[model samples]
Structures are given as C-alpha cells and as structure tokens.
Target chain A: MVREQEFLYASGRIRALETKLLSRTIVERILEAQDMDAVMRVLSETDYAPDFEELESIYDFEKALENSMKRTLGVIKESLKDQRVVRFFTLKYDYHNLKVVLKSRILGVEVPENLTTLGEVPVEELLKLSKGEKDVAVPKLMRLAFERAAEVYEETLDPQQVDLILDRALYEELNLLVQDIGHDFLKSYLAALVDLTNIKTMVRLKYMESDLRTLKKSLLPGGSIDLEFFEKMFQEPVPVLIEALAASNYSKVVKDGLENWVSSGSPAVYEKLVDDFLLGMLRKGLYKPFGLETVVGYLGARENELKILRVLMVGKINGISEDMIRERLRDVYA
Target chain B: MEVTLGQVLALLGAAMAVFLPGIGSAKGVGMVGEAAAGVVTEDPSKFSQTLILQALPGTQGIYGLLTGFVVMQRIGILGGNLLPLTTYQGLLVFAACLPIAIVGLLSAIAQARAAAAGVGIVAKRPEELAKGITYAAMVETYAVLALLASILMLFGLKLA
Candidate 1:
C-alpha cells in the first residue's frame, strides 16, 4: 500500500502530460494534409515544434522524431520512483540494439552508428559487449543472451537464430523483472505479449512455408497459450487454429490476423491488431488513482503516439496515399 | 489537585480524539498535496483549483479537534474545576470519543484517495474541477455524521 502511494506524484504528472499527447483528431489532420510540407506544418503545432523548426531538410523528420522520443523517455525516467518498471519499457530497445549489433557482427558488416539510445543500457556499452569484452555493464540476462546468441550463430551460421534467441531472452527477462516487482497487471501484460508474439510467429512461419521444427523453435515460453497448444496449431490449418483459440482471450486478434493473411497474403493487419489489443489492456490504467498502471499507461501511450507519427511522417515523405497511411495507423492511447 | 483513574481515562480519550484524526488528516492532506503539486508543476494556472481539492480532506481534523474540545469542556477541564467521576463515567466518555476518533481517521484517508484522484480530473479537464470536488466532498458527510455522534453522546452523558 505504501509503495503504491509513492506513485501519487508521478501518476498525477503523467495525467497532466497525457493532455499534451497527440490526439486522434490531430492525427487525422496530419493525414488529411496534402503533402509532406503540410504534414510537417501539422506536426509543428505539437510538442514536436522545436524539433520540426530545427529540421534542416524535411527528410530529416526521422531524427526529429527520435529526439522527441528520447526527450519523452527522459522525462518519464526522471519522474518515476522505481526505475525497474520504467526500465521494462525501455528493455525492448536494448534487445533491439543487441540484435542489430549481433547480426552485423555475424555478417561481418560495419556496426551502424545510428543505434537507438532509448535502451536502459547505453549503446556504447552494447557495442563493447559485441566485441566480446564480457566486462561491460550490460544486464546479466542480456549479456548471457548475447553470448548464447553469438555461440548459436557460430554453430548454425544462421541470422534468424539470433533474433529468436534474443527475442525469447527479452521476454524471459521481462517476466523475471515483473515477477520481482510482484505486480499482477504487469505479469499478465507480459503473458499477453508472449501469447501474441507466439501467435504472430506461428502465422508468419506458416506463411513462409516453414517446417514444424522451425515453428517449434520460434514459440516463446511463459504465455497462457502453452507449447502443447502451439504444437497442436502446427498441424491444423490457420482457420482451425483460430477456432481452437476462440475460447481464449486472443481469439479476435488471431482470427483477424489469420483471416487477413489467408485472404490478402499479408500479416500487416495482424500486427496492427496486436498493438491495439495491448493498448486496450493498458487502457485500464486510465482510471487508477495511483500505482504503476498510470505510469505504464502513459509510457505506452507516448510510445504509440511516436509510432503513429513515425508512420505518418514516413508515409508523407515516401508519397504514400493518405488512405494507406490511415490504414497503417494504430489506435491512439489518448 | 490530585488526578484520579477516571480522569486519566477521560484524558486519554480526549488525546485520542485529537491526535488520531489529526494523524489521518495530516496523511490525507499530504497525499493530496503531492498529487496536486504534480498538476501544478505542469500548468501553474491550476494551482487554486488543485488547492481546493487538497483542502477537501482537511475537514476531519477540525471535526476531531472540535469533539476533543467539547469533551474537555464537559469534564470541566476547560472550566478549571476538573469534574470528579466514577470509572464507568470515564469509560462512557471514552466510548463517545471513539465515534470521531475512529471514523475521522478512516473517512479522511478515504476522502484523500478521492481528492487525489480528483487531481487527475483537474489535470485533464480543468472545466470539470467542480465534479471532482463534488465527489471528494461526498466523503465529508460521514465525517460530519461521526462528529455529530460524538458531540451528542458527550452532551447526553450524566457525569454529574
């Protein structure tokens, strides 16, 4: 109880900050803009004004967006009393950087300098860990995953193995962190993420015409949908798998993604569905007065808004149609 | 003047009536301050509005002190005479104080939660601050009822 009360100030600040987040109407206005310059104009009206104003070229919107995300995360990190929960939000970025570094090492390509700074671990440290220094400040879980992924890639000489191993490790470590905090909402959120990832992996592997062995290797642990159920899914058709999961919580997402894949031969709709579902789960935090929920919810919302802006900006720059951009836009948390 | 066991029990009751609810109000008001400060930090314009919400939980402490004052007066402590009483009468006075001491402590905490939540409303919808105040003010009813109960019981006690 005392611990929950400690979040009172942070949660309230997040509530005020929530008002400043990009709303659906603003996104619609951005989409309605006729050209890239017009989209920039719309974005300039937001908290991104400073970044947008400083953009030397319209194409450099990606850098501006990155700056916006970094600033948002930095503010959230400062307000939070418990760094562990906030770190959970950024842990994915660390794994993302880790994946890029490991893959580039295996391919003998130059490590990209544009690595994200959003991770809990610094990119410089991640780069050092990639050099097999072993003494860097990376979390033990990630360091071990890094070594394991390196060893596995050397044996198989396959790049995909690195992603699977690292992805699994990310979730496993997230599970452990949430367990340590002892928050049931976070535990179940992680479970839902695992379940959705497994479902997405299954659908993608099925589309690739991969064998059952690869499918078995890709499924993650700790989701409510166990390995036995996924193994059963491997034998059945996509629709049958959807029906099998009908009684579970993910039936709608599974059905939407699978049906879209079956009809359009693409997993795009499924990816959107998964994001919307997770946001829906986090939306429960909006009503909570104090606790981890409000902080996590605001963080999730900010990340989602950043994602929406990225899609909009990329679409505008690439000259993709407004309707196409709208189709790809995920639900906003506000 | 010599202090009796009955007077000691009654004094304990008066102290509880003041301190217990005072502690509760302190906690409640402090919690609301933290939350209200968060809103004010983002937009200083909402200070007066959030401050109203912060004060909502403060009534319980006043009710507690008022009850304690009434008890002191009835016992002649305020009159400088110091009424002598049987042990049973002191217990009766002790029992009267419980209504405000217990209820004031609980209601203040509960109201603080409501008021802290109201800070969120003010943060998001400044126009709806009234509704937030209304919700937190609903909790004040119980504290008022508890104060009335304690006051009525003290006045009804036939200590003489």
Candidate 2:
C-alpha cells in the first residue's frame, strides 16, 4: 500500500493524459472527413499531426499510431516507481508478439514488420527464442509457454491449438504476476479480461458450431470465475452463454450484448460490450489517486486506441461506410 | 548557566512546532513536486498551473513556522532575551504547539496528495487549473484551522 502511494503523482498525471486522449468527437470528425486530404486535415488537428509527407499509406499512419502509443507507455513507465504492474499489461503485447513469431515460424516466413516494441522482451530475443535458440536467455514463464505451444502445435498439427496453448500460458503468467503484486484493482481488471476473453471464445466457437470439447479446450483458466463454471457453461449454446455472462459481474454489459446477439445474430455487439466493460473498469480505476491501476489503465487505453485508429483508418481507406466504421470502433478512453 | 526543565519543555514545544509541520510540508511539497514534474514533462505549457498547485501544501510549513516563531519569541529563544519560566507555564506552551504539530503534519500530507492530483488536472485540462486549485485548497482548511488553533493558544499563553 505504501508503494502504491508512491504513484500518487504518476497516476494523477495519467488522469491528465486521459483528458488529452482524442475524444469520440475527434474520431467522428476523422470518420466524417470527405477524402484522404480531409483525413490528413483531421490528423493535423490531433497529436498525430506531423509531417504529412511521410504517410503515403494507411500502414504508415498505423505505424505512427503504434509509435504514439509506444511513446505514451514509455513516458508513463518512466514516471512509475515500480513498473512491474505496468509490465503485466505489456505482457499482452509479448503474448501477441509470441503468436506472431510462432505463426511466422510455422509458415516459414519472416516475422511481420509491424512487430510492436511495447513488450518487456526484446523482439530480437523473442524472435531468437521462437527459432529454437538459447533456452535460458528468455524468461522462464515465456520459455515454458513457447515449449508448450510448440508441443501442442506439433502434436495436433493445428494452429488453433498453438493459439490456445499460448493464450492459456499468457493468462497463467499474468495471474502469477497480478496475484504477486496483490493490487485489488489490477486483480479485478485481470479477472474481467479473462472472463471477457473466455466469453468471447465461447461465443465465437458456438457460432462456428464447434463441439463442447473444442469450446472447453479454448477457454483460458485463471479467471475469478471458477473453472468448473466454464466447463459447465461451454456445454451450452451462445444464448445460454449469455445467461452465464448475465449471472457474472457483466450483467449490465451482457444485457446489451445479448439483445444485440438476439436481434442481429452477430457476436460483434457482444464483443463490443465486453470491450467497453473492460475499458470502463480500467477507466474507473483512475478515480483513485494511487496504485498500479492508472499505469495499466493508460496502457489498456493506448492499446484500444491503436486498434480503433487502425480499424477506422482501414475502414476509411477501404471505403467502408461511416456507420460500419463507427460500429467497429471500441470505446474510446477519453 | 543551569537549564531548567520548565524552559526545556518550552524549548521542546517550539522545536516540535518547527520540525513536525516542517517535515510534513517538505514531504508534501516533494510529493507534489514529483507529480508536477511529471505533468510538465508531458506538457510544458502546464508548468505554471502545476507550479501553483505544487505550492499549495507549503502553507503548513509557513503556519508551523509562524507558530514556532511566536513560541520562540515568547520564551525569548529567538528574541535573545531569556525569560524565566515555571513548569506549568512551559506545559501550557507545549500543549499549545500540539495542534499544529500533529494536525499540521497530517493535513499537509493529505493536502499534498490533493495538490499532486491537481497538477494532473492542469496537465490534462489547463483551463480547469482553478478547479484543481480549489480541490487542493479545500484540504488546506484543516491545516489552517490547526495553525490558527496553534497561534491562538501560543498567543494566549501568558508566562509570568
């Protein structure tokens, strides 16, 4: 608790940064922009405003967006006294990078160029570890994950198994880290993420008409909701899964998701609800002036923004309708 | 020259009045300084606004110093004119300094937290600096009351 108090300033500064985050209105303007020139004009109004000459492709703008998020995380990390809490949030990116590396290895292709520099492990080291190099150089938990994922992938010859193995491993790693710190907000946040991910997996698998066994295998462990619940819950259809979501802490959020799912027959609404729920929880953590919540919250918001920017930018470039692009955007941090 | 217990008690009271709240203010200001610097680091334009918020917790130290100065002068510690004191009279001054010593210490730290958060407000929303200042200033009420209680008691303590 005393250590949490040390972040009093850093958290406050984060709250300040939250206000500076591009608002829904700003995003709306970007969406409403007439053409690429108008999009550039809108970008000029934002923190993203820099040399327009450089952004020839939407991919460049996407890189710039990722860089901005990276910069923000770096600044927040620099300010924090104990960065371990923030480090846990960055672990998601590590897992993401892990997936990328593993997929690249499986496909016999080079690792994608858009690899984020956001995680604790360097890209070079992760890439090396993925190629079956030095066993001791990488973190033990990550090495364990890589080994598990590789074994599962080799045995099943299924890429999905690799994803599930790594996904479960990531949660286990996060659970260990969050529990060690014992920050109530972070613990709750991690639980929310797990539940949401679990729920999403259930929804997606059910939609694909997957068997209960496959569904159960996909569900990640280490969530606050008992593992027994998911074993039972995964047996039900997508609509029945809504009952579980309603029973859990996501009752309010699940209402809209379930309604949308019933009406549209799409999990898009449900997924968005979960995203908003997760983001809302993180944002609410900011009201308190101390602790790891703010640092983690900033990173979460940054990640969400990157996703939103990419979707909106790609949606615009692809000439996707405004309504479609708007539907695709997750809840904004600001 | 023999130093009496009565004079010693008076001196101890004065010393605490200076040190306790001073320490609190130092910590409070330091805490706010860290937050303010963080804000300024992100947005340099917010420096002035954050600077004002950073200064809020410092009042406790001033209040503490004021009480200590009064106690010192009354006891002739600072005036360079030593006043002979009985045990009971010294106890009165000691009891008088207690309000600021304890309350000032707690209040300053509490205020510092508010002030630090205020620095955040200025960082994110520079136009809302006044609201941030108001929030931080709200925490200063208890400190001010403690200072007042201390000063009034110090002034009321008439030593024969």
Candidate 1, B1-160: lDDT as tens digits: 7788888888889989999899999999999998888778788999999999999889999999999999899999998988997788899999999999999999999999999999999999999999999999999999999999999999999987
Point out where model 1 deviates above 4 Å.
none
Chain A TM-score of candidate 2 vs. true chain A? 0.91
The positional error of residue B147 in candidate 1, measured at the CA in angstroms, is 0.2
Put down candidate 2 lDDT per residue, A1-334, tens digits, no spaces: 3376677667766766777677888888889988878888887887777633457776577668766877787777777777777778688888888888888888888756557777778888888887778754678888888888888888888998888888888888888988888778888888888877776677667668788788777888777777677668766755676666676688876777766876888877778778888889888656656556667777788778777878788887888999988886898875
Interface DockQ of each model: 0.85, 0.50
What do the candidate models score in CA lDDT, each in turn? 0.87, 0.79
| Residue A257 displacement (Å), model 2 | 1.4
DockQ of model 2, rounded to 2 decimals: 0.50
- Residue B81 alpha-carbon offset, candidate 2, angstroms: 5.3
